[model samples]
Target: MHKKQKGEAAVITLVIVMILVMVGGLFFGLPLWNRWRAGIGGEAELRQAEFNRQIATLEAKQELESAEYLNQAEVLRARGVAEANRIVADGLGGPDGYLRYLWIQGLSKGSTPQVIYIPTEAGLPVLEAGKR
Candidate 1:
């Protein structure tokens, strides 16, 4: 029938228009998608910086706690050493107190001893010393 052919032509035109619209949308939407992808990169960088800041803060706290514990251990060590020295001094009475003398003697071992004289008073610089 002649009417049927005209209806088929209209349907063909409608299909063509729909395809053109879809192509236009594909072209126009490309830049929008690119912008969204660029924004995601910026958000990722911001999140990474926030995580780094948090990690640094936690590390600093840990370092401070470690330093505090180290100082406490050092204090305990010094106290123990002093107590042991006191006990040894009590056992030896006056003999254990000569450690300084022993250390000075150790420095002079297997070497000749030297003596030097020092002036008791400082003199003024010579103003008219003769020069050759």
Candidate 2:
């Protein structure tokens, strides 16, 4: 009977050990897994936010370049128009076809008009004789 009792005691001890192992695993593993998942989620969100900022910056730069180009084109147009009128008055065949005031408006879908002008003469446009 003592042998049988000892055997039962050993079996009970094994069961308690297994239960403790399972409980310990549950206590430690879950929090670690949850922390890893949260870290991954945070990293993904940070990457997405960074990408959005880069895109916005690129878009803004493109807009600024486009505006600069438009302003330059406006200056060219003003010069071309003056040159055309001058040539027309100077008996130069009434301003060549290439000297006509021309413009390309609306480069982007939402952009404003862009005007451009090309003069007929080789040199830059000259101011009116006495107008400075």
Give the Å shift of residue 31 in candidate 1: 0.8
TM-score of each: 0.63, 0.53
lDDT agreement with native, every candidate: 0.80, 0.77
Q: In lDDT terms, how accurate is model 2?
A: 0.77
**Could you give candidate 1's per-residue lDDT for residues 12-82 as a string of tens digits?**
99999999999999899988999999999999999999999999999999999999999999999999988
Off by over 4 Å in 2: 1-16, 92-132
Among these predictions, the greatest TM-score belongs to 1
Lowest lDDT 10-residue stretch of candidate 2: 97-106
Clashes within 3 Å, all models in order: 0, 0
lDDT of 2 by residue, 1-132 (tens): 999999999999999999999999989999999999999999999999999999999999999999999999999999998886777546644445324332111334436543434354876654453434
Candidate 1 wrong stretches, greater than 4 Å: 95-132
